[model samples]
Target chain A: MLKKVLIANRGEIALRINRACRELGIATVAIFSEPDRPSMWVKQADQAFCVGPGPVARSYLNIPNIISTALITGADAVHPGYGFLAENARFAEICADHGLTFIGPQPRVIAAMGDKATAKRVMKEAGVPITPGTDILENAEAAAAAAKKLGYPVLLKATAGGGGKGMREVRAPEALEAAFVTAQAEAEANFKDGRMYMEKLIERPRHIEVQILGDSFGNVVHLGERDCSVQKPSHQKLIEESPAPALSDRIRKSLHTMAVRACQAVGYVNAGTLEFLVSGNDVYFMEMNTRIQVEHPVTEMVYGIDLIKEQIRIASGESLGYAQNDLKPAGHAIECRINAENAENNFAPAAGTLTGVVFPGGPGIRVDTYVSTGTAIPPFYDSMLAKIVAFAATRDAAIARMERALRETSIEGVNTTVGVCLEILADKRFRAGSYAIDFLPQLMRAGVS
Target chain B: MRALASLEGLEGRVRALAAAFVQSGLVRLRLSRGADDAIEFRRRASSAAPRVPEAAVFSANGAPERLYDVIHADLVGIARFSRPAPAAGLALESDRELASVEALGIRTPVRSLGPGRIVSVLFDDGAPVEYGQPLFEIDRE
Candidate 1:
């Protein structure tokens, strides 16, 4: 077991790791940027270190500084909590090289899964259903031909890019050339990799993902699925639910089987989520997120699993204690990602100090957050402030509990997505579980934005 | 004196008093005017001093003296404190070299930023610093 773990991230996720460590009888060290000096996570940890200034590149993302902190503090393991360097294979390798265990998969697995195109190829070879896409396009010329064959309205994506960057939706054949150049340039600027992939666009697809956990003993189990179809303009997910409401039993079974097989094929260890795009009844692999996801709380709520703890146990070379039979999604769980953003605007990033806050609490309500009253929301990082999730016996009950929780929650000073989330819950389409990926955009057209 | 209800409350008061008095090397404060509840702050003199952030304490200094960090944050390595200040370490009129911190890969000079001298050392040469941690103090040099 890891005696002391260093959390190489900040905000709510940092607190999340600290809580898990405390329960497991382990010590935790928190690394923070200057702006996050007053954050609750810092004060709560066993030891705290200021890594660098406010910017991510100098602070949170500074691998050398983080590693030095772990070494100086005698931390045996490092947890890259879900963001900054969570999925960075290089960072993971550095930790290993420094004699510290990284609380995730092996460095090789992270590297293999990080490349979208290579990951697609690996899954396809494993007999998993992948979207109709070509291998890494050599250049824009290759994309042009691939798009021609894939038909119009094809999507061009950077194999190395994520969060909607280096992505272009070409509606017609003529626009493919410009879209390809722009995507390659964008990818180069952001990821320094110009390699691209072309795929047949799956329109109005429901974003569904299967959760899996594997141990070093080659044991892997599926933890059902999460419906993250609701999103904003920038592909930012706002809400997620477990058991993926309205999914057919056949589709659900297939999704679970495919996810397990995908992990087994990759020899994956530790916690991972396999993302799939479902259009109509058919599902296809989008990409594998090798890191624990933002929506993991929904799965945790539904399955009663402490994923952070599991990640630690698995990294220690322990075999999974539970098999597929021991796990099954019971009832329903829903999560709302409350961000420091203005719903009235175009979901613009709203950064300022939080002067007042009243987080909702009751039975079946869990809030993972770092900010408190008087916390400054720095502009140098991600805007997500808190993850508010609720659970109940049924999907409807969970929705009702979440809605009530959202209603009771109050935040002052900075603008939040509370109003937009309320609007989503009240919308008839959302209430009926008939909403798709376009739900947030449609709401923005008529509602807050 | 009224007893402190909790150590947390007492510690908070002591740290608050430290920030409130930058000119005085020692800080003493009472809880309220009506109550004789009072506390004195103590400093553990070492080579490296856990710096109370300059902004928090010096904001009340009233003097427009610019505070300088003797240690630059980006230099990563073990920090060693130099000899104790020559003058009871107060009211330094100019910047002066205080210590030489040498790590395996880097060497840095710890200098008194302005007209201040070493008030106290927070840690010995074997001590290590995270970003922005203070190693020494110069008081009215």
Candidate 2:
């Protein structure tokens, strides 16, 4: 077992990992930027280090500073609490080269799965269903030809993208060329890889993903599924639930099997998620997130597992404590990302000093936050202020509980998405779990109308 | 009155308190040692005679017109204000209220912008203020 672990990230996720490590009697070292010197994670850790300045590139993404912190603090392993260098294969390789265990998938697996095209090909070879699409196109003419072949309403995706960036939906052939050029430009700008691919856009599909955990010993199992359909273009996941309500038992079982198969096929270990776009009974693989996802809390609440702790254990060369047969989702859980964005102002970033903060608590409400009264929300990071997750025996109860928690949440200094999240939870279509990826956009448009 | 004269030496101390009040958005500075001797006076208009209020006598004494107080509201910092008296070298001193200090309204409740932790309390007593000013600094978690 590792003596100490260095959390190479910040915010709620770092706090989440720190909590797990504490329970497991593992010491933690936190690395933070200058702005985050007084952050909750820094205070919660056994030891803390000032990595660099505030910009992510200089701080959280500063791989050398992170490694040095780990080494100096005597941390035998590094746990990247999602984002930043979590999926960067180079970071993982460097950790291993320096004799520090990276508490995630192997660097080779990250490299293969981090590339969308390669991951798709690998999934297809493993008998996973993928959307009908073409490989990366060379230019606009080739993209137009591919769009014509795949029929209209195709999605232009970046080969090296995630978080909904460098992606566009072209409704017809006329829009294909322009969308292709724009998508390429965006992909190049964001990921530094201009490579673009095309996929048939599945209309009115539910975004469901399976949480899979594996060990190096080849033991792999699916924890269950989470419904992440309530998303805006800002990539804020307003709401999420477990055991996706729309899916029948047969589809659920198949999804679970597919998730396990995909993990095994890729030799995946540690914690990861396999995302799918489900339309009716047909489910198509979207992509695999090679690290812990933002919505992992809902899965944890429903499945009664400490995923971060499991990642630590797995990285310590321990086999999964339970088998596939032992897995069972206990209850319905929902998570709402409370972001510091003004909904009335097109979800623009809201930054300022928070004067007062009151979080709601009851039987089923779980608030994961890193803020307090008088905290200054810097503009350099993500806009998510907190995550309010609710759990109950049934979906309706969970929804109701989430609604109450949202209403009780109070933040005075900046505008937040609490109102938008409340509206989405109360939405008739969302309540029925009969919405799609375009649900929020349609709601926003309707509001404009 | 002699304590008030010594309080004039509290100029640098008052300015530091003022800056802290502005930065904290809410700060409370108590009249710690000289409460009995230090008279907390608000300036009032002199009736018909065009006479300055007794509070403005300090400014008229050429004892630096920059006297200020760090106001607190129920242990929360509110605002900072220079002793509001008639302007210096004014021909006619109007009988107007020099300044006003009131408790913060409960209905106009303050709130936080994000989930952050309170790092420090700048004020033990509530802050006093003029009209427009900050209250406190919340450290983001």
Which candidate tops TM-score? Answer: 1
Task: For model 1 chain B, give the 10-residue run with minimal summed lDDT.
Answer: B55-64
* Tens digit of per-residue lDDT, candidate 2, span A1-449: 77899999888999988999999999998887756777899999998876665678877897766776676566899999888999999999999988999999999999998877789889999889999998778999999988889998899989887777789999988888888888889999899999988889888888899999999999999999998988786645677889788779998988889989989998899999999999987899988988999889999998899899899999999999789889777989999898888877778888888877999998999999889888878767888879999999999999999988888889999998888888888889988888888899788877832
Residue lDDT tens for model 1, A1-449 = 87999999998999999999999999999999866887999999999988887779988998877888888788999999898999999999888888999999888889888876578789999899888878889877888889889887898989787888899999987888889999999999999998888889988999999999999888999999999999998778999999898889999999999999989999999999999999888799988888889899999988999999999999887789889999867889999999989887888999877876999999999999988898878789999999999999998889889999998888887889888988888888888887889989988988663
The CAPRI quality class of candidate 2 comes to incorrect
Q: What is the TM-score of chain B in candidate 1?
A: 0.46
Q: Give a tens-digit lDDT track for model 2, residues B97-117.
A: 222223222212333333443
Give the deviation of candidate 2 from the true structure as CA RMSD. 14.8
Evaluate chain B of model 2: give its TM-score. Answer: 0.23
Comparing only chain B with the true structure, the TM-scores of all models are 0.46, 0.23
Best by DockQ: 1
For each candidate, what TM-score against the reference?
A: 0.84, 0.75
- Candidate 1 RMSD to the real structure: 6.8
Which regions of candidate 1 deviate over 4 angstroms?
Answer: A136-144, A158-166, A174-196, B1-77, B82-119, B138-141
lDDT of 1 at A168: 96
